[model samples]
Structure formats: C-alpha cells, structure tokens
Target chain A: MALRRQVCFALYAASRATTALYRPLLDELGLTYPQYLVLLVLWERDGRTVKELGEELRLDSGTLSPLLKRMEAAGLVERQRTAGDERVVEVRLTAAGTELQARARSVPAALVAATGLDRKTLVELRDTLTTFASTMDIAAQELAAKKK
Target chain B: MALRRQVCFALYAASRATTALYRPLLDELGLTYPQYLVLLVLWERDGRTVKELGEELRLDSGTLSPLLKRMEAAGLVERQRTAGDERVVEVRLTAAGTELQARARSVPAALVAATGLDRKTLVELRDTLTTFASTMDIAAQELAAKKK
Candidate 1:
C-alpha cells in the first residue's frame, strides 16, 4: 500500500486540489465550495426542502443547517416553514442568488480546463467516481448495520 | 451544467463517500480519516518533519498542528524540534504507532473490496486522478500569481 498510489489518497488529493483550483474562481463570486454546491442544487430546482437539500448533497442537518444559515445571511437563499407542514423548511433562491447563476456559468468550464483531460476522459472519470460513490455508500450502510 | 454531472461534484462525492467508508474501519483503530492518512505516511517512512508531512498530505500547518497534537495525545506519535534547526519539528511514531501498522494492513484491502472495482480499473483511476491533481495544482499556482 504505497501512500502515493493509493486510490483513497488519489481521491482525497484530487478532490482537495480541485477545491483549491476553484477557490480563486469562486472567491470572485463570494462562494465557498460547499455553498456553491448548495446553490447548484437550488439553481436546478428552487424551493427544495432542507431535508431534500441534505439528501441531495449527502449532508446531515447539523452541517446543512449552519450552511443554509450562512447562505441566508449572505442573501443567497431564504428558508421558510411550509404552512401545511411546520416541520418542512423549504430553501428558495433570492434575486441575488438566482442572478448569481449568470455569473457562475463560467465556473464549470474553468474546472474542465484545469482537469487537463479531454471532455470524454473527464466525463468517464466523473461517471466512474459517481458510480464508485454509490457503491461506497451501500458498503458504508452495510458496515453501519453490521456494527449495530 | 448539470450539478449531478459535474466532475467537481463527482470528485467531492466520491472522496466524502470513501471517507465515510473508512470511518468505521478507522474508528475501530481509534483513528480519524486524516489521522489514518498521517499513519499511512509514517508507516511508509518514520520521522518526517512537520513541514514535510504538511506537503505530503496537502494540509496547511493550522490543520496539521492540531492533528499531530491529537495523535501525540493518543500515544501514536511524538514531535520533537530538530537539534540542528529548532525551527523544524519532526514527527516520529511511537512504539504503539509503529505497531498499529499491522492492524491497518487489513484496512486498505477492506476499502478496495468496498470499491467493487477490479485491480486494473482502480489503478487506472488512481493514476488519472494523480495526474489531474498535479495539473490542478499548477493551475492553482498560476491563478494565485495572476491574483497577485
């Protein structure tokens, strides 16, 4: 198990490196990586429940709650309890948050360029990682259940 | 720019998922994911400088210092300032730390099995990610310079 060549290390390194690359690009737009992700979900479909946001992002309430609070403070999103269900809090984009999308359009192309791999290879890698994540999630669930 | 299809998102998800998979495994050894990474580096080569560990792990001193302190508290590592250069702190594994290697041996195989990938595909993906990380690092440096 060479540390340099380990798959887990590769994933950690690549993900951090990608985040580092995005730092400057996103900084111009006043967005942290996780915040950008939250925005991405809302950009695709506005007014998702905080529960739905957490499920989509694989984040827990503790983490997503504070993040959403920060986003609300920044005027990017506004959270409200649905009248029909007080337990259901929905996250909807603000005018500024929705308009930030126009400025954020350049972000993805910037990351693709930094990858240094052609479109097809990058797409393949993304799809493979996505599949690997699903498998790992299942494994984690099994491991957690076995522990119980 | 579909959020689900973004390479950045895939990388983030895969990395976090892998870390989750490693959580229970590492917890059994009383180690966190970053702590496990430190042990992996130390297992390969003992007594690396704090700066060296930071570079190897791509962590800033602010992050690494507390981690090393925690490891020291756990009797897994000891840090000493070099006699010749008091500025440099060396991290050496303790007897307990050195012995933890044998226990950690099964950890890598467990992760690989959870991955559900054949050897060849995993190797290729690791190599690709390694290269991608390097390219992204260079891009980050250039962006930093441009910002200056």
Candidate 2:
C-alpha cells in the first residue's frame, strides 16, 4: 500500500486499539472513551462552556449534546445555562466527576506501560500526531469554505 | 495535560481528523472511510474470507458483517459462502469495485497534500502507529485474560 494510505489506516487502527484497551478500564468507571475525554478536559480545568469543550475535543454540539446529556444522567457532569448568557451552557464536573480523576490517573499510566515504548518515543509520537491533526483540520476547514 | 494522557488523545484526534479529511473525497465516491478501507484490502488481493478481512482490518465480525452487507447492497462487492466451507464467507470485488480503484487512487494523493508532511515523516509515523496498535492489542488481551 502507498504510504499515504497506510498513514491513515495506521492512525485509525491505533486509535481504535487504544480505545479497546481502555474499554474494560473505563467500564469499571462507568464511562466510555469519549466520556472519559470530556472528564480529562474538565479535570484539567473545570466549568467550561459547551463551545469551549467542543473546541478542545473537536466535537460539535450535535455530537457533544447527547454525550453531555448522558454524562449528566450518569451524574459525572452537570450542565447549567449561564444567568449572564442564557445561550451559553457551562459544563462542570460533579463531585463524583472530580473524585473520579484520582482513579482515572491510573488509566494513562496503564496505557503507557501497555505501549512498552519509552517516554521520549511516545512524546515524539504524540507531538507529531497533534501537529498532523491540526494541519488536517485546517485543510478540512479550507475545503469546507471552498464548498460554500 | 501529562504526556500519557495527551498521547491517547492525540491518536484519537488525529484519527478523526484524518477521517474528516477523507469525508468529502469518499463522499464523492459514495464510500464511507471504513468501507473504502475494506475495498483497499480487497483490491490488494480479492476473494478474502470474512475472517481474513477481519484480521487485516482488526475489526470484529459484528462490525464487518454489516459493513460488507452495505457494500454488497451497493454492488461494490459480492459475498458468497464457500462451497467447501459454508461458514466461511468470501468477499470478492465486483466489476464496479475493481473499477473504483482507479478513481480511489486520487484519495491518498489528496490526503498527502492536505497533511503537508514530507513522505518520509508520514511513513515513519505510520510504522510507529502500526506497532503501537499491535502492542496495545496484546496488552488488552493480556488484561482480559487476567480478569478471567
């Protein structure tokens, strides 16, 4: 296969593999991979608006809305419309959500050990992928603009 | 975020970004990204059994069965239960499926340009991710075995 084709498939397969590895771990926490991601962002800095969270996660409201609703139902997060701006809904981690972070810390640790790659190698891989994703996102935006 | 947390998110985001970039291109071809991947494997060597395709793609039967059914409905491929082993369903590219390969060649070219990364860097990244995914898969299996 061409390098370009292999690159995309590699990323796709790796992402799914990572998620599959996390499945059992997250299941015990009653969270899915995406839900865990939302918590990761919240754990970093809580009380983010829906738009902010969407921007960080590269997820639109159409996808985030239902996900947030489910998270709220699970009692991990609470969404409240701002009094100052009714249109803006802020998502805050619940007490349970905040408490879950301590346990969630082990997930990444387990994953790192699972990869068996040295810290430096993993960091380089992460940085490269981050830059790649950003470049692709820009290209996608330009393509969408051209379609308009 | 710690490097550990960021690594998984990086892969997750990059995979989605890659898929998003392919969305428009594949849409024109009336193929979803996963479906295109299935065709890629078939084009390489047609008449692969469902099990073989699943192994190559790292997809389970639950996922591949429906996907193959959709592709069959679209006349892109045909699936037949082998006479020698009725349980083994072999997937072969149809005339349309084989012809689509010509047009599909442009996809990787477009993606390469979109990413703006040098071919060498992309190739290295692909190789690393493929290995990373394989390692994680083994870890997941080990974890599952421990649970049992």
CA RMSD of each candidate after superposition:
0.9, 1.6
- Regions of model 1 farther than 4 Å from truth: none
> What is candidate 1's lDDT per residue for A1-148, written digit by digit as tens?
7689799999999999999999888999999999999999999989999899888989999999999999999999999999999999999999999999999999998888877789899889989999999999999999888979
Candidate 1's C-alpha lDDT?
A: 0.93
Per prediction, fnat is 0.84, 0.81
What is the TM-score (0 to 1) of chain A in model 2?
0.95
> Quick one: RMSD of model 2?
1.6
Task: Evaluate all candidate structures by whole-model CA lDDT and list the values in order.
Answer: 0.93, 0.91
Residues B34-143 of candidate 2 have per-residue lDDT tens digits of 99999988888999999998888889999999999999999999999999988999999999999999999888889999999999998899889989999999999999
Tell me candidate 2's fraction of native contacts, as a decimal between 0 and 1. Answer: 0.81
DockQ of each: 0.86, 0.70
User: Which pairs clash inside model 1?
Assistant: none
